[model samples]
Target: MRDPVLKHRARGMRMVPTDAERHLWQYLRNGQLGGWRFRRQHPIPPYILDFVCLEVCLAVEVDGGQHADSGYDEARTAFLKSRGWRVLRFWNNDVLRNPEGVAASVLEALGGVRRADTCPHPDPPPLGGGGN
Candidate 1:
């Protein structure tokens, strides 16, 4: 179930994500990131994340000038990290200017945990009838 507060916040204001966000979304929207689906403006627990890859517990934030407030960003990052989520931030310009680099970095981070299943070994058998 989704958090009520998050749902309220989401409904309160439509966040017109920047150009960088749109660009990144193009790559991430359709399971383009190694077939991992990503959500935009996702609310995770108590916080609203810019983008989230639930499959890998990855969060991406595109920051504009307002994020210069070090204290706030630090606190947010700390909170997310504490929740077992890895957060990655990128300047809006960086993403707008070079989305490929951003994609590469995200892919690299995903590398460590890109197995078929994050669960421990002793893999389960294929669902339904195997070989087609």
Candidate 2:
């Protein structure tokens, strides 16, 4: 069970997303990615995931350089895996630099299927002129 404090923290996090998380959430929210619904800042047991496609038990984490050598993240990955969730981590720069690639990777993880680099967003809204 998710503790109350953790749940509260998760709620707050959803409101104050980091730059990378904000960018990533645009693709994830509103089922824009092939109808694959994703939740942001979802609390699970003892942790909060950046994005989770619960339908496929997949969690995507966008981490900054600070996390590159953190053992805590390693432990978190292991814990999530032990609970039957597949985890994916992308560097903040990578996500911001190439969200399409991140989207491609997420697609692969969700269904073991791959899309070409130009996999367009389903029911795409005006994306402010070609910037992901």
Best by lDDT: 2
Residue 34 CA error for candidate 1 (Å)? 1.2
Model 2: lowest-lDDT 10 consecutive positions:
114-123
TM-score of every prediction relative to native = 0.78, 0.81
Off by over 4 Å in 2: 113-132
* Off by more than 4 A, model 1: 11-15, 115-132
Query: How many clashes in each structure?
Result: 0, 0
Per-residue lDDT for 1-132 in model 2, tens only? 227798899999999999999988888789888888889998776788899877767789999989989999999999888766778999999989998889888876767633223322212445566645
TM-score winner among the candidates?
A: 2
- Reference-based lDDT, each prediction: 0.77, 0.81
lDDT of 1 by residue, 41-124 (tens): 876656777787877678899999889877888998998777677899999999999999998898888888864433221123
